[model samples]
Target: MKEIQAVKSSLNAVFAIKDLGQLHFSLGLEIAKTKKGIHVCQRKYALEILADAGMAGAKPVSTPMVKKNEKLFEQVVMHDVSAYRRIIGRLLYLVNTRPDISFIVKCLSQFVQAPTKQHHQAAQGILRYIKSSPAQGIFDPKDTDIQIKAFSDSDWASCILTRRSITGFCIFLGESLISWKTKKQNTVSRSSFEAEYRALAATCCEVQWVTFLLEDLDISVHHININCFKVP
Candidate 1:
């Protein structure tokens, strides 16, 4: 704590700063410190989103998205494109603390330029899901072990319009999830194996970056488990 105080004191000496005492809320994220860990969420921000969409009392859904169907591919453009784009932008920010919604947000982001009625509906479904658990967020345990693990997966040709693959992965520090991403691959994969390989390669790069980061922080990573599905 003294080291942190000294750094803060030095910064204060050089630049004007106000001590916030403790982090409870910042940039839409709400932090709660506990004996188990530090929990972070955006319940208030989520509520605001729901209120903006006039879905404050909408029925909650178990899943953020529905099964892929023909309706989703229809090019019937939405009348108000800006509203859809604004919702998507807010949801993108919400993904910072909601990993469960990461893939869906990535999927919806593709339609921002020309969102359709179906796309707008899908975005609203995500809001309904958010209503289910507005307080859901990542937890960093206080007694977490110094171990790194990652899991990677890919869906071959999941994009109906482009036939491109989507890569998703999550990295864990002990039992706490620290980093995750859901991204569409730039090129199309010929086979599932190729898709899986790309996802695994992306995950490996993230692991390497994370290991270097830990080393910089003087935290030695003795065990790193990078797990992926066996390619057939």
Candidate 2:
């Protein structure tokens, strides 16, 4: 636990907050320590989302998106701009607890410029799915000190307008998920390799920062960088 102690020391040293000796919550993510396996969920925020989004009574969905729904997020987002933006904004926050939907959420996030009825429907569907499985969350055991490996992927020319690809990445510590993200490239690329290369550059920067953070914690990683996968 030297890594944990070192990181804690760094954080405490920088923030000047008195160390409590245990972590229950940080960065909006809740933590529960125990003798048995630990579970992490957005229990408190999930309820709030259900109530506020008018989805408490909606039926549960097995998947984030329905099958055969070929519409682009921008097309669906053109109907109700205001409501779509509001719900999507909330979903962005909810992703902290629901990484499973990270990719879908990032895709839908693009249509805030002009959300349509289809967008509202799709967003509502996601909320219903969450309502049905509010207790779903990441699980990290109380044991283990192994380095976890992950993969990042991106599909080029995915955006109809910009032809920019979508980038996805996941980070793990032993068996616990420490970070994950999927996003659209800011610039257009002529080929899949270019897109993947740009994504690699961006992810590498994150890798360096995370590695430094781990170093401060005294945790060691035999392999620090995650594998990046690409497709045209």
TM-score of 1: 0.96
Candidate lDDT values, in order: 0.93, 0.76
Tens-place lDDT digits, model 2, residues 1-232: 9997898889887787676766776655676767855777777777777788777888888888774244664343353377778788988988987998887777778677876677678888888888878878888887866675666777788776777888777877777888888888888888888888877777777777777888898977776547887453
Model 2: residues with Cα > 4 Å off, grouped in runs: 1-29, 67-70, 73-81, 230-232
Clashing pairs in 2: 3-217, 77-114, 77-115, 77-116, 78-115, 78-116, 79-115, 79-116, 79-117
Give all TM-scores, in the order shown. 0.96, 0.79
Show the lowest summed lDDT stretch of 10 residues, model 1: 65-74
**Per-residue accuracy of model 1 over 31-88 as CA lDDT, tens digit each:** 9999888999999999999999999999999999877756777888887899899999
Q: Tell me the TM-score of model 2.
A: 0.79
After superposition on all C-alphas, the RMSD of every candidate to the true structure, in Å, is 1.2, 4.5
